[model samples]
Target: MSTLTVILLSIISLMYSCKDNNTAQSEDIKEIKSSEATTQLSPNTTTTKDTISIDKSTKTNTFTSSPLDLLKQNEKAIVTLFQEASPSVVFITTSVYQRDYWSRNVYEIPRGTGSGFIWDEDGHVVTNYHVIKDASKAEITLSDHSTWQAELVGVAKEKDIAVLKIDAPKEKLKAIKKGSSNNLIVGQFVMAIGNPYGLDHTLTTGVISALGREIQSQARIPIRDIIQTDAAINPGNSGGPLLNSSGELIGVNSAIYSPSGASSGIGFAIPVDVVKWVVNDILKYGEVRRPVIGVSMVAENYTKGFGIEKGALISSIFPDSPASKSGLQGMTNSRLGDVIVSLDDKEIKNNTDLILALEKYKPGDKVKLTVLRNNKEMEIDLTLGSSN
Candidate 1:
């Protein structure tokens, strides 16, 4: 072992060690590339993706997907849903007549725009009553951009539901698949399909914020059993379908609790259960066919007044009406009226309660009404009839 020989031996050992280190680094690089090939970003996050690996040729880091595609599953499901449901959703435009100030000529002007859904293969479109309210003419535009004149079929203003018939071909019409809202739970995934702000076939996704909600319609009637969601429902989204994850129609987008008429994360919808009955009745009888007691009740919430804390008072009975035929007396100018206490043994606390109870029955159904008249309680048996 001379000095030169020893130095040569040490250099050879160092070379071997360097070779081993280089091989290890090469293996590590291969493993890193393999891991990158199989990596999947989180679905819940939409943040910007960091630079993954630098390319020696390009001298810059390359990214695989956009921040938007982080939630690929949710996005794919929404896209599929829109494809299936968008055809069922239709755009609605209403027109009203107005007299010009200068020309004094009556002209039909576009009143408002809204959204609706096809109810059946017969081309019955369902929308909010206010959407076509006071409109002398209306037009429905399908997803394929074909416009058709709509004929008014039936309407339930209290429920804010209106059915319009279009003579669209069956091949062009797609009826929405109905789902029951009776089993909905809060926080479940929901999607809204509509034309919001005149945007056609817009899809907004959210969770069910609440259920069994109540809302007032333009006709001053309380629409009960509403479904509330955070989906972005705006001005033109009215009467559109609110769907569950299965692309089933759960509710109809009716109103929003926004200050600026924009989506403030609070939107209301009429449940499908109510729409089911309302539409069925409309198809059968051309209207809701709700039984009328044929007694005039004071307007402006008279049933909730201080004089009569509860019970719907009979203001006046129409001649040849069920009440008139049953010899029911109405209130006069100087005295009080017959306050309806109960119907069919159901407790009627106020006029709204009476209306709701009556909604459970149809025209020509026999019902017993217990009334408080002249400080005495009496039962009156009357066969329900149409209000005409």
Candidate 2:
């Protein structure tokens, strides 16, 4: 072959080899791209060679925030809840129409002014029973400067709760968010929204001082499980809502344990549980069906060292009474008294324990009682009788 022909033939073979290598590299790159796309599409199918994972050792980090940061974050929410709930809280003033003793004519006298909250869209307002006691006329003033004559729907003296209805427009009614009092604890944040001393829509904040407190209503009935707060509650704050931070009504501001008729940093509220029970019974039956076990007993102190040092000393059991039928052993000679020690496996420290145990059960229910008679412990079952 000639020199020019050999050089041309060598160049053609080199060009063919370079083209083949390029084609193979392109195919390999395309396959790799396709495999990457598949892996991206199905991430679950992608697994690591090692099955066990170890903890990643990363640099420690700390977060620091200002005290006002939390307040700034929640201020708007808190304001919104207060503004929405304030309208539901109404100011109530009562007037009583009494006939002159000598004239025998009718005249109206202002009783008192207090706070209340709309219970429903039906214009039913709930307030302290003492607020409207002896009042023949009640005026309910809404947040919008609208007024309506209210009629008493129901009253629960024991709970110091009363329900009143106003013939107002449904659009004006704002019901409060009901909260559970069973979950309340000491030192939790509480807010009181009410018309204090006739100032409308006032908000006071404090912590729950205590729980399960006992107080006396104006009607002389003992209210149990009352919520104690130090939220600057005053005279006009009665019947107003004691709300949680979430703006849920936990209690009704009822009484303050102070020498002066002002906020002495100790205020009591009726728990929402009692309010619920009273309201439900009043709305359904027009009266409170208070369950009581009809039996009167002497105090253990009066019969000290007479075989009835503790527990309730059964003094008398009426004929055909539930106690009589339940075979509760009483003093047969009217001199030796049997001491009750426990009920339903619950130890009875004194008469208070017996009363507490009985309060937990309704009439017509059976309770097991453990008694101390002649220095011996004995158990007996007794059916509770109705108070009525």
Candidate 3:
């Protein structure tokens, strides 16, 4: 064999072997890519890390909890009380008629809002006098969401109470059960239901902080036997019922002592006992039948100017009146008139005292008056007359 032929043969064989090796390597690479694609497309297959994560996510987290406790006795009582009493509560909104300057058209504009309650089946609603004060008309919204126009029945300004009549059906009216305030004691629980700040049917609970409290009415007359409570009474709570533990109306929420015009835990209510008589008189006569002494009393300032420290000074006596029949004298330019120092053994410090004392009596009732005449105290008998 020739040397050149041997070298050529060896080079050709080495080239063919290298080509086959390259082809085999290409096939192996293609298989590896196909396997990777299959692994990615198969939903039944997962990597070890992925399987661990999937198993954790499928498990739900468990939590342990304590059982809820039932409501206490007082709590249950309050709930039941509210449910029974709230239906009798009503919301009152007052409006004033105004005439537009340019159009000259009269229309009603909202004035304010307050609370009231159904007084009887005849559709009589009772509320605070100040709530409807300066208002031309009012609307009463019952707890059942029925609204009705109300007419002014009567008012006792000195008592801070006003009665309104509605034309609603008797079936819709729910008269509140009345309770006695004369038997009420301090520290007894009281629940007040009203619309505070226009939020209807709001209930506030507190104990009677005091009894026999005195508060001024809208007419500046002193309202005796007022109820003081710690319940939350705001602007719109006026005229709502103050209920005792038995869910009976004991008083009517009237005023609150707060500098910021909000409840300060000091609230006042007109006792239901006083309310009964005042309401009866109003319903019967369209006005309070307060007994009249038929004598006009001078102002406090006028009495003070005359060196009178106390007692209600007689300003003038009406003709054919009770005072005239009793010979009660008035003050003259040179002499001080008779000043009532006492009435029926009750000290008459001022006109307010005299007025309050006379409230306990009815017309034609005889009363003894202690008068200061000519710097000497004397007694006189007089018969009370009805202003009605």
Name the candidate that leads on TM-score: 3
Model 2, residue pairs in steric clash: none
TM-score, cand. 1 vs. native = 0.77
The residue-by-residue lDDT of candidate 3 on 1-388, one tens digit each, is 8999999999999999999999999999998986786565454434552342233433343344334323465678899999999999999999999999999999999999999999999999999999999899999999999999999999999999999999999999999999999898899999999999899999999999998889988898989999999999999999999999999999999999999999999999999988999898889999999899999899987789988999999988899999999999987788878999999899999999999999999999999999999889999999999997
Candidates ranked, most accurate by TM-score first: 3, 1, 2
Query: What's the count of clashing pairs in each model shown?
Result: 0, 0, 0
The pairs that clash in candidate 1 are none
Q: Model 2, stretches more than 4 Å misplaced?
A: 1-72, 219-222, 298-309, 318-320, 329-341, 347-353, 363-365, 372-377, 385-388
Candidate 3: list runs displaced more than 4 Å: 1-71
Q: How close is candidate 2 to the true structure, as a TM-score?
A: 0.71
lDDT of 1 by residue, 1-388 (tens): 7999999999999999999999999999998975655454222223234644432444333467776767897688889988998999999999988899999999999898999999999999999998999999999999999999999999999999999999989999999999999899999999998888899899899999998789997767788889999999999999999999999999999999988878999999999999999999899989887788789876536555637766788889998889999878887878777888899899988777888899888789999999988878999999999754
Cα lDDT computed for each candidate against the true fold:
0.89, 0.81, 0.92
Off by over 4 Å in 1: 1-71, 99-106, 299-306, 319-327, 332-335, 364-366
**Candidate 2 lDDT, 222-326, residue by residue in tens:** 678889999999988999999998888999999999898889999999989878877877777776665544456776567676645457777666788766776
TM per candidate comes to 0.77, 0.71, 0.81
| Per-candidate alpha-carbon RMSD to the true structure | 9.0, 12.9, 15.6
